[model samples]
Target chain A: MEENTTTEKIFPPGSVGLVKSQDFHFAPGEVLELDCGRTLRDVTIRFETYGTLNADKSNVILVEHALTGDAHLAGYHTAADKKPGWWEEMVGPGKPFDTNKFFIICSNILGGCSGTTGPGSPDPDTGKPYHMDFPVITISDMVRAQKHLIDHLGIKKLLAVAGGSMGGMLAIQWPISYPDVVESCLAIATSSKISPQSIAFNWIGREAIMSDPTWNNGDYTEQPQKGLSIARMLAHVTYLSDQSMSRKFGRKLQTAEDYSFKFDMDFSVESYLNHQGTRFVERFDANSYLYITRAIDYFDVSDSADGDEHKVFEKVKCPFLVVSFSSDWLFPPYQAKELTRLLLENGNDVTYCDIKSHYGHDAFLLEYETLGKLVDNFLDNIYKEKEGK
Target chain B: MKIAHNPSDSEPILSRSDLVMIADMIPENAKVLDLGCGSGRLLRVLKARKNARIMGVELDQEKLIQCMERGVPVIQADLNEPLSLFADASYDYVILSRTLQAVKRPDLILQEMLRIGGKGIISIMNFGQLDARMQMLKGHMPVTKRLPLKWYDTPNIHPGMLSDFRDMCREKGIKILKELPVSQHRDFLRFLAPVCPNLFASNAIFVISK
Candidate 1:
């Protein structure tokens, strides 16, 4: 939509890398009104679309971003932004989400710190960062915002909609909210609702952010940073696997051999966590973190009905392909299966696979090579059949 | 406590309402085979409703997808053509719901149904209603709620009356374990047709066994 040239190397040959952002402008310094009644003026969403949209705009695949992910799904953008695309393993020329045949669209979520409008934006109502005053948002509300973006792109029907984790939740809702729009869906490492333990971890992250003295009730515009760093460290633990952590570090020391048992970073785990947290603050805003995580925390679900028996199970009219990770304790397998069962009972076309991986809840994002093959096959079938339709 | 094993436990293909009714008739934890199960809804319900093990057979690819989605154990195949897959009397209850009229030869299917389950439930719409007669006289086959479609598009290959089916059952030595008919949807056709339902009843939902 715009004449823009950008490039950045994200990963080594085999693994997946950073997510990118590119889009048409609604004019520079434009203001975006959020569904929460909070307006984010002068806002931009980082986005990338692979393959071709075709003549009918039917081969579009909307990829939802994970917690800390941006829209940059592959390649580079600028020198300031270094790192491979987040889904480097799963998406590329010939991966599962094959960018070769389908038009893949990914965006930095609304409340994300990277390029999207979030709490970091100037609050039109108050000129300063909305901080705690940023109204709470639901997953439905998040979908609502994305709907605007989709409409702007002028896509009519989607061939396949897919995502993992928070992204997966969006993929599942896509068909239900916009029934006739999606042909088949790919929902991985997600659930109908977040588990209790996930909520607890989210709260812990929030508390750690609030407890920091630098987080002056979220008023430190220049740097309400330390608190967000701590929150990221805690969240990072949940993202990685026990086996991965053990294999990568073990009980080995980060520095000295002897037990200095002080508050210093003795274990490699501590050093790794600190590094992840410290890097997070540089690209992210504390207020935005507060807003987005809370949005994810507020997810609660039941039957997708609107009081009509004949119309109740009618919402999810599209074919479903749901995948949940076996080792994802946060959302877990039961919740995923529960989603599968409900959709099945409602008479929707569905396929669910619970992938076995010890990479923990964030495995869907990291375990790209495995996820890549599944995506590739799933899309190739759809693409071939989609030709006639 | 005698629960049978089914392949479709991982993929249930029935609706909530269909499952509820199927559950009501089946004994708790009994062996079940749901034929023409659109996504194994009834079988899945029986599984959860009574912890009964169920095997479902369906033809449609979409419904099969739904069955797998629900984790109800199911096999994607036709219900007719001798069910040599399982042994004789491998099931306790064989269910054919709203699928009788759709089959080319329901009589053969019913015979298989009885052979598979010691007891079986057969739910079919009564085509010998006064409404069909009225439409026949008025020169339009019939289009009531029970017979929703106009003749051409109807899925029912051979529509027959309740008495007609019962007559066929009698010929096959299939005794009526229970026979229930409906007019106002689930509310039994009572007061009007009780002692003799041949003329008054408009729809029939029955349970029979060999």
Candidate 2:
């Protein structure tokens, strides 16, 4: 584990070099109390920071990652790495996030297989991987653990909390959970509660992962690669829209003269999905997928406030920018509109934009130019308002 | 009577006399909501001159971006839908300028405006004006300066006369606090608009409250 003090000196002041991820471990006495009536001891958070923290620490911007994302939010870890961070287009020296002016921090969420504490983490009591023994965590629990990381960094308030999809869920939860610490929230392709259809899709993915013969009831020595791959294939379909699928691969053969009519992957779309599934299983854990999906399924902001969503959102002191893609069927525009209505009813400043896109739920990540400009303007306005105050 | 020509190069697209009249009625430092705020021109002017805290509701994507570019906070929403997001009497003024006829339910929108605001300012082009009535006599729909487009291309789905709106307000128990007639004609016709606004006024602006 690299210490914070040492990592801070790795990059010279005013340079825009790629920052490396570091592990921050809290002692057993500093356990994170979970909503499931269980506690996670010696919690470790893997986070990466971009840009420099200003003198007052008011320029901090916390970027939350989605269900399958890690702490590598921007820049390549090494020059040899083929790919940059997951959201590299939106966060750089002169990008919409503008690392030149603001400090950016992204951490792997709790119950995540990344460098965070999750099912893959060792159970201190048993001296083995927690696996199924890990307590079910909620989005609020993930946020609470992130609060610890932010406090460790000595940031009093974040200029903005932003994310898309599952990341957007955390963005919404941040202001509700820590109203005084977040100045503004930008929630994209997310909702206050998961729809029944979304829950059904997630259930199907979990079933695929658990039904594999090699699962060994969550105690297997070897990872459940087959089941995890199938589950990922199921999810990869939902991330793309029918229009996008057809436009990219419409009944085209996958390097074949004619269809073989067998169970083989003949169509280009099927081949693409298989490739995605194969690549995903290499980087993600099956047990972590089950736990994180469960956390998302159980998320409902109203549940924490006596079943009143208005009461839950009444605690939000910051303005919000709720964005949704036109073709995102999974987390559609109406869901975002409903959330915006609730926020407005509570007398909070909320702006909503149903961006026209055919990129489905992943539009926020794919359509960076439009999303980037809107977010840039929104953040610039917020910064100006704060300066005036 | 001298008719006003197309706006000169010096003026903005929103420099219509009716919009200017509406902007004049708004006080300084007020909390204002501009419904169907196309490109946020009125709200921008209000923010600059009155120092008002303004929010806008616009449905068009391009206009919404324009509003954002001008640093005006706007929600992308159709005016035909209910403004249930806003609390009752939350805004000092709610201005629906030149968009009443285009809505599906103008009466409900007016009620919602008065419900969510202390005062509601609505400006509508009168379909029962002299030119419209004369066109009706000639078996043609009017396409005057206020109602510039042809019937097929116009967005005014529910073209209403000034008297019709007054009657609707009366039936709904809404008090008309003030009324201003906007006319293109400079002298005699402009003077006659106040006397018989339903027949002579090209457009009308009404301030109402519940």
Candidate 3:
């Protein structure tokens, strides 16, 4: 049976199988303008695609990645790779994204570190890394850069723009920023604006990184591992719920049945967070973290509407699907409901759901059964409607 | 599951007669919002027949997926809770079919329906029919074709008669634009239902405006 299983398949059922990433570099003369009133040149975007684009080019879908996520959304990069894409379950041949029927594209955001133009990328003018010199960005800025990529690909209108968490913010921005180009949107487990509580958490995470002596004011020879790990540890707590933490750890000791009587990371939850922090520091740059979180903090779709959140989407014409988790304190269900209300007030067709889950904000990554079905059916319906059948 | 048979061959096959009657009340190209829309059968018929812009709110996740499968826009929400997400007078018609008894506050839901929509259509099971009255006379709870479940196990917590609905509407200052007694079975009750709706009809559909 072991030999049969190993020889029978190169990839699992519903898998996108082996995939490769591609890069898109902006033309020299293009010189993209930023929301912060600065101009950037030689911008690069790392992206990946699945399925075929079709004859009419109407089967394209742009999937946005959340914080700390990259262009690799589904399938194995290599045959021996232990982990598939972050959204492996939702983006395969028969999964919610249904790669067989629609061409799926996911790109690293402009301020993202994974093969995208960010703080670590070299500055053409200075002949060194941009570092702190990288223009301050916003969610809209990331989406603006994405629009250029979509236009370059010659897709006149996208079937849908979808994502969760910070990705959700980008999804929301796409429809508003380019209403005529996007046919629909799926914003899951996200808010239109960052709440004060969220801002405070981001502040603490940034503070942890800046406090490290090795950080060297964002110009350190070596990456600030300790500070970045501490930041990741604190940020990880916000991604989980009290119920989830209690169920997973429940004050369980790491190696002993009794208390250690000293602060040596004895609790299981502490050890788990430490491991997450250390793992994150290895792949992510601290400077990129500062820029991306700041972009998230500055995101407010209602800025053009005199701070009236209800009128943010008045000019947007596409239908929307908004999903939130019951235990997601970071982007609570009420916040999502508020966005739905705003859409309804403008007479926009919007479907909203608060999925019952204990996985908190991370429910967007987990809870595939319920969330996946919602996306699958939602996107299918939109496609059918667009076809006029 | 027992499928309700409709006598009209041109109408949708899966929908009950009461749902057909409710769909008939809506005009062509009207925007509709259906509360407690189970599997979106009525909305599908409306979309196909009237070319109506359709949306639904269903509590059951499975039914919500079924609605999406039928290309009907739907929101997952409890009818018992406040439906404040929908703006006032946003829809041309709001429908609550065969779900009045199951909700915690049918009166409040009616008001909310009319508040969000220009007109509200409701189809309720008539508990005062002759079969139920006969069961009561025999000192047993009702077990009619329409009200099939036992009293203790039923989700219908506030079942009422057609007269009760009229009186509630009068007291609540809700104008009943039209009312129709519906009987799906091909029996004498179908003839008598229209004459004495409170005692013979299996169900009643009401079109009301605020």
Per-residue lDDT tens digits of candidate 2, residues A347-368?
7777889999998988889998
The regions of model 3 sitting more than 4 angstroms off are A1-9, B1-12, B186-188
Per-model DockQ: 0.02, 0.53, 0.69
Looking at candidate 2 chain A, the ten consecutive residues that score lowest on lDDT are: A6-15
Could you give candidate 1's per-residue lDDT for residues A165-244 as a string of tens digits? 88887787677678778888888888777778888988888888888888888777665567788899988888777887
Fraction of native A-B contacts kept, per candidate:
0.00, 0.60, 0.81
- For residue A372, give model 3's deviation from the true position in Å: 1.9
CAPRI class assigned to model 3:
medium
TM-scores, one per candidate: 0.62, 0.90, 0.94
- Return the interface RMSD of the candidates, in order shown, one decimal each: 10.4, 1.5, 1.2
In model 3 chain A, the worst 10-residue window by lDDT is A1-10
Write the number of the candidate with greater lDDT, choosing between 2 and 3: 3
Better of 1 and 2 by TM-score: 2
Error of 2 at A6 (Å): 28
Give the TM-score of chain A in candidate 3: 0.97
